[model samples]
Target chain A: MLLLGKNTQKSVLIAGLAACLLAAPAQAEEIWVSNEKDDTISVIDVATMEVIRTLPTGERPRGIVFSHDYSVLYICASDSDTVQVMDPVSGEILHDLPSGEDPEQFVLHPDNRHLYIANEDDAITTVVDVVTRTVVAQIDVGIEPEGMAVSPDGKYVITTSETTNMAHWIDTQTQELVANTLVDSRPRHAEFTKNGTQLWVSAEIGGTLSVFDVETKAKEVTLEFAVKGVHPDRVQPVGFEFTEDEKTAFVALGPANHVAVVNADTYEVEEYILVGRRVWHMAFNADKSLLFTTNGVSGDVTVIDVASRKAIKTIKVGRFPWGAALRP
Target chain B: MFLRTVLALCLSASAATADVSVVIHYLRQDIEQPPVLSNLDPIPEDLGLRGAELALKENTTTGRFLGQTYTMEVTHVPPGGDLPAAARSALALTDLIVLDAPAEALLAVADLPEAANALIFNASAPDDSLRGADCRANLLHSLPSNAMRTDALAQFLVQRRWDDLALIAGTHPDDIAFADALHGSLTKFGLRLRSEKTWAFDADMRRTASQEVPLFTQDLRDHDILLIADEIHDFGRYIAYNTWDPRPVAGSEGLVPVTWSHVVEQWGAAQLQSRFDKLADRPMRSRDYAAWAAVRSIGEAVTRTGSGDTAALRTFLLGPDFELAGFKGRPMSYRNWNGQLRQPIPLVTDRALVAQAPLEGFLHQTSELDTLGQDRPESACTAF
Candidate 1:
């Protein structure tokens, strides 16, 4: 049955991490943004905050993530129906993995050997063996699976289905759906706390952020946005981030042009930091000192200082910048 | 490691499957004569049913991955047929029903005790009363009501500063209903009805009397636009360029407010149009879009909840947790007060789309789409 109890899979991940001690400290230290319309990935130097090189790739490059050791980068080239692997240093194509169909987003396993990819159109979550570059398992999920998050403990992998309006919880060990927790409409992203106690999902059209208890999978609270001059319809909650300390969060309010800083424990929306138009996904730099947001319509990335919660810079990017990820 | 992987594969393979059955019940009102139109083709035999079938296949594409499969059973009843009996038979089979019938027949089917536990989608009937005083707890409408369509046009006219309207209505039941809706919109938007007239001509315009059609529309008072209410397609299309005062014609003629149109090419609508065109071998109509939306609503619910239980689905659908992407550049959801779907109405000409209503200035507390129809404050429906 679905909604099974949480399995004890953390020990397995901890043991795996113990073996890869050398790869932990030598971080990649780079920022990559996928320009959806450009079908290319732009790498930025973490120290300089400047574009190093633009690597051409598949049809629609929406999601990008670096492998745990930072030797390889996996790009979910959605329109091409494959996830392309590339060497970060030389920017050379390593291989292409059959990632179901329309791979919009993916989460690399903590074990550093398997990758969980969300196929947007086909409603399937394919788990691929990174070493073999072959699909290990394909789990059925809801329609338009866009956002994926692996728990800190690595026991559960949750994929937020946009059309289905639910965050499907998949047991990592069994590769079967354990629970379908209904959220608001058009959930674009999901992020778990560093401690893995709570999961936050952004519902873009529903104009709310839902917080859920990780173990029980019960909705704890729903937060709504109210910008002073903006209409409620424009206050679409999209991608969000939870600080490493799990005390604060920054949620990108698309079309509203604001990022809401929320109190993680109290679930209080503290302030709305203004940003660019149609602000989408966000990423934190190496030290969590700077937060970068890809503004789709405005074609720029707004950089926010984490300490002051103020936007400091707006860097121009390619057309329709969608998602961003940082390696350190 | 190999043993654990093998065991995991076995466990996932034995996972439970979620199967949902959706039944479409339509009352085919038999008529002795169909409309005689020279320019446009006659209405198809399988108008709404074909759309539901296409959506079933679309749903199955995604459903197969979730271990969910959708099956549609269509029951067609003849004129003066036992619609209630047919609805009862279908209700016994599935709790998810799509009704492609008239207002009265839909109400009869909804009033059944067995349908209390069902989640019904109204695919065809566009009567305002269905979303107003006669709304049911089980019935969810995908089709936009007459009030919504008229309000959409009125909003556009107000935005364009076309304050004066010359209203002409035919002597048909549906025409009268549309006329009433137009009058309501005029009052809602503070527009002036410069002149109102009724046409009683029954002569065939395809024959020698075609010249008289234009002559009949002449001599109207000062008006910026001519709004025709001819649901029977008798004179709406003919009055476009033949209007007496050289005014633009709308409301079922030159520039119409519709639920869906083949001309809509924005917000990924081309993908749906192309997919539907490949399936139906013709351009998709408003009725087809309505039916497709109805089935997709159910498919969305089942995919989210992972259960076909009617009570859970109904609760989730009526609650804030429901919204379906209808290829309108926005997410469409149901209004809790009345089960009408709150969506943007596209104003389209024959060749290209003009604009979507609930236009920029139209404001609402909850959603802008509420401005296009009977909002929660003005809704008289409390059935649910």
Candidate 2:
């Protein structure tokens, strides 16, 4: 309660500056999306719901992800067949990492240095070390690999092949496909639970979500979605996110124009929230109170209120906006 | 037997360790394609078979993990050759046959005693009779029928609010079939046809199209769309950009209904197109996609039942349990009433995809896709 002296105030100021240095990235909080068709990334301010910056990227920029520390961003650059590392602060591309052929999707390993990328055309999962900028391994998985996910413990990496209809499990230590688990046809995205106890995969063509036990690698549950007035074929389950408590799930049903609110524990759909057309992927905000969905067909992002399960705003983005990443 | 086996597969749920081998017998007839008016893109020598090859490659991708193996044995019949004899021999090896031939030739093989147990996929013919009165229990159609194609066109046109319609039907049998189908679709969709002309000219369309097309279409009351029913690819190409009234030409020429096209780059179709281009060294056509779908249908069955026994496979195929990832932005399935693959028909030109049918508002009792082709009520087949 007492007033501080001038000497004490100067020392406190120095300590505060040191903490700010350690924290870094004190800029505006934003959500970045890779526009596939436009070959650009749209950076939208989370607070203002407006595009703050647009950075040119390689051909067909998709599957965007921020580094663990939110320092750099990695873009798939699918048509260019390379992974582009970019400085998020300056919007300058740092370098190109060899990403085999048609790297459509990828997951950065927990090591934060290695990226396991799905080379779709080559039917192999390419592991590239970001620090070294070299290919660590190219493990053969299945044909037309699209979805990539890494376990929380970094012990297992999963690659879901679109045509093969199997999720190829790669051992991070051996960099080999230790097991292959068959799922519904045309599996597109793979996601692991927060605790890494379960793995959920979305099948775009199959119109189903398959959940597997992480330990035994056994399929524990299968969730199917059917929204009224939406064609079953159009109800393609693509990308999904779990709520903060991991009790609820929001699944993006591509072309169905709806995001399904599901009870994660019961594996039942609670409600359907109508969003933009052909919703591809989504990213939650820092507080987990708001979710941003990338609508590929409509060329917009639907910001949803998590608690109410309602779309609060529509943020127009570049053409065919694909992947979403939050910079917090 | 199929139901029990599929149930076992469902119960096992984990490991499918049994090596299920499937051999698809591809029987193609080498008939002289009707002369086309365009020389820009020539038909590939290996058109339909290339699609089957690619599908086999794709099936093997899933088969490798599911303990299944798929191989294709193709036999090409020379023009005016004994197709039934060739089909009989192919059927001796395997009951799963994919036939790429004209409607009559397909019927000749389907009616054979050996084919009674065989499951044949018609990958080339667009004849509606094959899906209707002439339907066979063993023979299923992967290719869209003439009615399906025309209905897709009709849906596209109606959804775009194009009301006035005129038809230029060729005199060939295939053309007549297509014209009839289009006429039926026009009526089904409640769009009145303003005019109908039969193109019976024996002169070279290449030389006379510019000179004769205007006069040929001169007498017609100008309509919104001139649907050219040149299913054989003759004269239809000449109609576009040469119409007397400058009307848009559809049907076989401009924005045609096709099973697959290089122009379709949506819904992950670009990846498929790139793969096909790499394999065949040319753009994939409708026939190629038909064959691919046919082969993939068999693969789906084998994966589901985990066995290659044709009878069990057929039972599973005709049953409601089968769904195919058709790359058509839909989970395609066979119609039990007529054995036609229910899929979204892509209406496209050689350049770009105009739209996919079952457009937006076309509704049906069961499925919106059912509004495109001959629905369950309209199906006249008693095959099942």
Candidate 3:
């Protein structure tokens, strides 16, 4: 396996050059960014910090998630209504998984057997069996289901319905809706803590992050964003990622162009790290040394040094860069 | 495992049993409406009601998961019927009401003391006065007002550099009101009104054998576009191809400003249009879209607030946190000043979307959507 070593000093050097040039012997680990309008994925080599290649994909590719084994990648081609499986190494189409209509975003089950897809138009969560490449279940959710997350133990699959303004929970075993906790408006993304005790869902328009107790399915805390100079309407929280230690959480504030770093235990926004316009999604390197964010309107990905909490580089990509996934 | 199954079943059953009902108090005056010019398409019989029905189904689909039941009771009353009685009946049934009546009927229902606590959504009436001095505390407007529509058109015309306008208004009172709004918009945008004329065609004259249209529209001078304000749909549709100057037509027809149009296919609107078409067996009109927005707003409030209590729902709606995703590019919320829905107005031609209003560079301190209609400072709504 190719690994991008967490060399802090080397990354600091690469940050100054705007682009990294790697030796020929070093194996390249690539990060894929899905460009929604371009209908392609820009592969950036971690060793070189450059867009090595662009691979064509289905129409309006928005969300991307990798399998546990890292051999296959699933792309949510929203306009095509199919979760496409591609070989991560070769960037070749492997199979077309049967997703519900207008699948916007999805999450892979930890068990490596199933995939939970949020169909934005059909108001349902489509469960696909990975091995069989067939749809196993279709669970009814709220209108415009756009976000999906599975619990740490793979017991519950949470779908955040944007229009319905609720986080709907479904049992993984029975494929039945278990409970629904109302959040704020336009909930775009949901994430479970590493310990599985808390679930954080981001409301894009409501400008707040709602944290819920996993056991009771009740909201425990709500975090609102307020920057010193940023207006209230611009601070839309869309995507979120937790640190490996679970001590810090990074939220992608869409249109505000800032990623808010929140102290996980205290639920306080510690700092706002400015990125690009209309930031959509985020991913971390294998060693958790660096984080990358896809900025839709700016057509670039902002790479942030995890330890320093500073953006290192902004690499230009295709139009409307949406979801990002790192393979090491 | 058996115990867990039993518990899950019990939980599901209990969740499924709870019910919440919403009634669309569709009070329409039962009278023969005057026919428009033959060029325009005939209005649908279930114009506003069908959209509310589709929205009810959509709400119920999500409501089922949340263990809530939503129902719409559409009551049509005759002309000069007991509208207050109809409002009382609907209030007894459901606190949430969607109004599709005229200005007077809307005011009559809103003026009722029994409806003081009830939530009313206006889906049809587009009078600017409703959002001005006559604005009510309990009523929220879903449809765009005449000022908003005209301002939307004005912004688009400014963007296109169509400065000089020839105004032609209809004979109806509603037409005159719309024309007045157009005049306000032209002045606000600093555009030149080259000439103004009122088409004095009565309902019978609209169908006359005489060539009055050509005679009236002939010999217009120094105008970039002909702006018609035939809100009754009487003469606006015919003015497009019949104009002697061969200039473009806009306003009530041609390049019209609308809240929603079938041609709008951006920002995931195609999905909504298809969903509505499948349900209504026709393309969604602006009125239908307005009615749908009203019903969906209530659903969103109930879902977000997680309460069936009307007072709690109203608080959440009037609160700063309320927002609804109506398939537009951004989330829509209510303007607290006048209870008008703050949304981007789409300007469309007959077959394609031209552009959305509150155009680029029209800045506002709070939101760009505020530039399209009455801003907070100029608003006369003192009642909240």
What does DockQ give for each predicted structure?
A: 0.12, 0.24, 0.20
Tens-place lDDT digits, model 2, residues B218-237: 87875888889987777777
- Which lDDT tens digits does candidate 1 get at residues B1-384? 211122121112222345554344433433333353454668777777777877887677556545677788877787778888888888888888888888888898889998988878888888999999999989999999999999999999999999998888888778899899999999999999988888766554444335665677676678999998987787676677666567889887777999999999754475567667877888889889999888888877776676778888888788886778776756788999999988889999989999998798888878888998788888889887
- In terms of lDDT, the poorest run of 10 residues in model 2 chain A is A1-10
TM-score for chain A, candidates 1 onward in order = 0.90, 0.93, 0.91
- Residue-level lDDT tens digits of model 3 in B150-253: 99999988988999989998888889998999999999999989888888775746555235666676866689999988888876766776777778888887
Residue pairs with colliding backbones in model 3 are none
- The clash number for model 2 is 0
Q: Write the candidate numbers in order of decreasing DockQ.
A: 2, 3, 1
- Candidate 1 structure quality by residue, lDDT tens digits, A1-328: 0000112353343345445645655544567888988988777676667777888888878888877656788888888889999887788888898788788888876687878888876667888888886788887676667788888778888888776666888889888777777677778888877467888899887788988888677788899888988877668888888665668989999888999999988888899999998888988875578888989889888889999999988887788888887755
Steric clashes per prediction: 1, 0, 0
lDDT of 3 by residue, A203-230 (tens): 9878899998887776889999987666
Q: Which 10-residue window in model 3 chain B sums to the lowest lDDT?
A: B1-10
True contacts kept of each: 0.10, 0.27, 0.19
Docking class of 3: incorrect
Q: Which candidate order results from sorting by lDDT in descending order?
A: 2, 3, 1
The superposed Cα distance between candidate 1 and the true structure at residue B119, in angstroms, equals: 6.4
Candidate 3 scores a chain A TM-score of 0.91
